[model samples]
Target: MSGTIQFKQDLPPKGGYEPIRYKRNLPARGPGGLAVFGGILAICAYGFYKVGQGNLEQRELKRERAWSRIHLIPLLMAESDRDIYRREQAQLAREKELMKDVPGWEAGKSVYNNKRYNPQNFVVM
Candidate 1:
């Protein structure tokens, strides 16, 4: 009878029971630190290379533009000088007609301010 005796509320074991989802889980290993750093460095190097190429291309374009402007300067000056010469010729003709009855005065001749006043002077931009 003593051996067969049982308590009304059966107690659990001394060690606690494990949870239901107790399967063994192994943590996944990621990429090594050196490999990750190398990948990041490669990306940065590619970005810098592209930027340098763009800067070089822009510099070439700017140089071409400056050279073109330099080449056109003489032509622009010539055209301007031609226009000024035509205007002076017209002014001289008008002055000769108007002052014909009057005495010895020239059209484009100035006693003073004559050092660089002619249309032959090359105007620079």
Candidate 2:
């Protein structure tokens, strides 16, 4: 009977259990120290990775710009040549018309004869 005896409580504290004494700011238990070290290492690695990526991106942009400049040189030369050819054609046409009106040349023809077409005066783009 004594071994089987039990105690029962009819009321409980209003605010639950409390400790009369405890240690303050004890060194954290578990793997907290390892977790903090790992976290710092991960942050540093990420920062370095981002820096490397930025450098690579900058180099790629510079390479692309160089390629664009190289490609544009040929295009500019071709455009200037085309403009010159068109101007030459216009000059030849004017000469042919002048030869046809040699006997009956008008004042308008004389006025236009002094004005010549210049390739450099035109904009390609």
Candidate 3:
């Protein structure tokens, strides 16, 4: 009822103004963006390296196969030559047996007689 402000007996105590104490808990920043980019680059580089290694292996395998074929070619040729020589030897043996009992039909004479007799039988126009 007086000119000055008055409070009731049960009013709360008045204290000096105090700023709010805000505890800023920083968030956990995950792996850096640059680190992720670097990891991707490393993976790509490793993939390329593996591809190059595979190509090299393929080339080496091709070379080995080519060399094996090259080595086999000479063996094949030698076998063919041996077969031809055997055939010639068998032919000569057969010719010897055929003319063995023939009189005056020796190895050289038989070949010469065949050539000369065939020409004589052919009439010239």
Candidate 4:
């Protein structure tokens, strides 16, 4: 189809024709947006890795504490028992020393220094 239509009136000549300098209307985008997004993603990934690492460390520490408790309980009980035995032995030695000064002390009744009045023998006023 090569049919062309001719205008009867002459058209005015176009004056001061300014061509478009740029093709796209959008502003120039540098690597700033991509760099910022990449930086945020990297930070998030690092935080996630740290959280996982901390959980593993916490679990390891708990396991070690449990193991220490399991192994030290028997030793601690034995040490407590030894301390009690030593205290009893010391008390027995002191009692023996005190008894050495008196002859036939066990044969006599045990005496207590009673300073207070006997409440059991209270008389009705």
TM-score-wise, the better of 1 and 2 is 1
Residue 15 in candidate 1 has what lDDT?
A: 85
Per-model lDDT: 0.79, 0.73, 0.73, 0.72
What is the TM-score (0 to 1) of candidate 3?
Answer: 0.42
Global lDDT for candidate 3? 0.73
Model 1, TM vs. native: 0.55
lDDT of 1 by residue, 1-120 (tens): 466876677777678776678788988589888999999999999999999999999999999999999999999999998988787777778777777787777655655665766443
lDDT of 2 by residue, 1-125 (tens): 46576878777588876866666767667778789899999999999999999999999999999999998999999998898788766765766665665776542233344577433433222
Error of 1 at 77 (Å): 3.0
Cα error of candidate 2 at position 91, Å: 7.2
- For lDDT, candidate 1 versus 2, the one ahead is 1
Considering every candidate listed, which one attains the maximal TM-score?
1
- What C-alpha lDDT, on a 0 to 100 scale, does residue 39 get in candidate 1? 96
Q: For candidate 4, what is the TM-score?
A: 0.44
Off-target runs (Cα >4 Å) in candidate 4 are: 1-30, 92-125
Model 1 misses residue 21 by how many Å? 10
TM-score of each: 0.55, 0.39, 0.42, 0.44
Look at candidate 4 and tell me the lDDT of residue 13.
Answer: 56
By TM-score rank, best first, the candidates go 1, 4, 3, 2
lDDT of 4 by residue, 4-81 (tens): 986687665587557757776787677788898999999999999999999999999999999999999999989988
lDDT of 1 at 82: 93
The Cα error of candidate 3 at residue 13, in Å, is 14
